[model samples]
Target: MAVRSYFLDCASLRDYLQGIWHEVAYDGLNSVVAGALVQLAFGVVKQTESDVFADFPGQVSYETLERIITRGNTQKAEKEFSAARHALVPDDQSQESDEAFVDLKEYMLSDAYRNLVDFIVDYQKNRNGFPTMKMLMHTTPWDPGFDLQQATKEERLEWRRVYTINWLYVTW
Candidate 1:
């Protein structure tokens, strides 16, 4: 079978993000679980489609989406890093730290993110299936020094939702 790619408009993506952000952000476990369940419902839409759909006006390709994501991530990371740097203690009358921090942009755009996107797209388009639990676990990203076994319940849930959000972002 010929492989196909999904495309969506910027407005649609923005609106979807807003909705999910509203639903999932800072409410409670119930809200987060609701978001996860809604994401599963989202999978149903993906599963029902079996055609090579034509691109629509204002719809962006994956490359376009990648650029958009990169731009947004860069801006957010910059603001966050700037805030963090300013919050740090002054060293020898200098506000800026002599020590260098990890590049936020590079970390945000790391291969893990790309691999997760690739895995989802391939599973949906070429295999016409969802990833197994093992595949999902391996592909999902965690903090560099995070220890899953030592994490609290909330931490586990937060980490679990990150991948769900990424899947919904790409596949929705």
Candidate 2:
């Protein structure tokens, strides 16, 4: 389901995420297991080869985007998303630390990582909303756990380097 996927509206994306997260969290997977699954699912995630949604319009619907992101792998994506959130920001203290990425006003000002965050935001703005990590993860297509381990160091780093803080879209 990685090669191609349909864009989605918001409700569908949220449902997808909630469903997957519930399943993964149901068994209380350990941090190690959860983290591994997140890497696996996000790996298969991909952008459309071409912009089929591009046209004279405001933005893609959230439900449409959900399908686009999940690429039919809601289970894997949501599980990993929940795992990553738990790993990266397990508590209030961890959340503070994670903020360091977007904490730097310079990064936000320079737009260094804004493009990536904007991708999801701009689409969600259509319906006056934003997607949570779990929502986005469930909706997005991603790799399996083993492939994440097999990827090159650079590939893994690139995946990890994404601005999760920015994904939160908080402007202070």
Candidate 3:
């Protein structure tokens, strides 16, 4: 909230930029996170809820989470999130319950990314690795130029229609 509001105007983007020096910045997400999450979040900039939800279910399908994480809001969002996100992961046993750190490490590199690692991690953490397959293919970002050849325009349109329904009824 603070970041968006603060930088709502280009005039403020300059102010924040001036405040920072000698810092390596990406997306201006104010914290230094685990490199893996940073990779997922920044690596695949998303345009739809299904794309993000299919990958990261535990995360609220709301930009509020990003806004809170990056420029302000801080722990408040985290606390509210944990309370509401359990449904995303309905599994009785976490596949890596016994090996937490190892799993996080392995998950970051798994083939599951399919081009949207951040989204997948969100699903794994929140949805319990249970988002449907169609959801995955539809929401995951494909390189605009590269994916266009691999996927027909009609197929993309169909996926967009499905996503529109899913977001409208299920997520929204």
Candidate 4:
């Protein structure tokens, strides 16, 4: 029998993170920031599908949804999660010392981004028994193809033109 790997769909992943988010303190990070970080990680993994998926069949299957469910010692998990979120906060000291502007784009490339990726990767890896396929985040010039004029006001507010796609693969 071919060993199958389990993976979380976007919704499942979002739900799992929501549970974590609720357990942890905001620590200067809100749900939107957490969600964006997750999407960015996904995008990084998607970019590597060509290279990573070559060993397996091109066809993909979803793992059982239950695998993504968050459970146990939520209080402890919350504390750890809060710490990770806190790590992502832009250093006010840097801004004061150098008068440097730390923007969202910079945060995507910061140590906090790395920690968030590590935290998510570790959780998913342990929870689903999968290994990290890829984790990355990057920003580029806004795509003109996403015509803001054509988007509804609500859509424009919710739209992330530069979001990343995340993927996790496991071999059993």
- Pick by lDDT: which candidate is best? 1
Model 2 residue 72 distance off true place after TM-score fit, in angstroms: 23
Q: Write the per-residue lDDT of candidate 3 for residues 1-172, one digit (tens) a residue.
A: 3223322332233334444422336446444443444454433333333444555557653344344343355344334322112222466643432311222111121222222444444456546544456655665453344454566756655454444434433452
Could you tell me the TM-score of candidate 3? 0.18
Tens digits of per-residue lDDT, candidate 2, 19-137, equal 55676788664556655655654442323323435531465543344444445555444443321132344454543222111111121121334444555565575544555555456
> What's model 2's lDDT at 112?
31
lDDT computed for candidate 3: 0.39
Model 3 residue 125 CA deviation (Å) reads 9.5
lDDT of each: 0.49, 0.41, 0.39, 0.39
lDDT of 1 by residue, 1-172 (tens): 1111222232234356566667566654467666775686566435422232232235434444444444646555445332224334555453653544444433333344555566666567546455656556654674656788999865765565565545654575
lDDT of 4 by residue, 1-172 (tens): 0111212233345456666576555455576767776787577546544333554565442121111111233233233221112223365432222233323222222233444455455557657654334432322333547778998854443334223212222222
User: How does residue 3 of candidate 1 score in lDDT?
Assistant: 17
User: Candidate 2 local accuracy as lDDT?
Assistant: 0.41
Clashes of 4: 5
**By the TM-score metric, which is better: model 3 or model 4?**
4
Candidate 2 Cα deviation (angstroms), residue 172: 14
Cα lDDT of candidate 4 equals: 0.39
- In candidate 4, the residue pairs with backbone N, CA or C atoms under 3 Å apart (3 or more residues apart, or in different chains) clash, namely 42-165, 42-166, 43-164, 43-165, 43-166
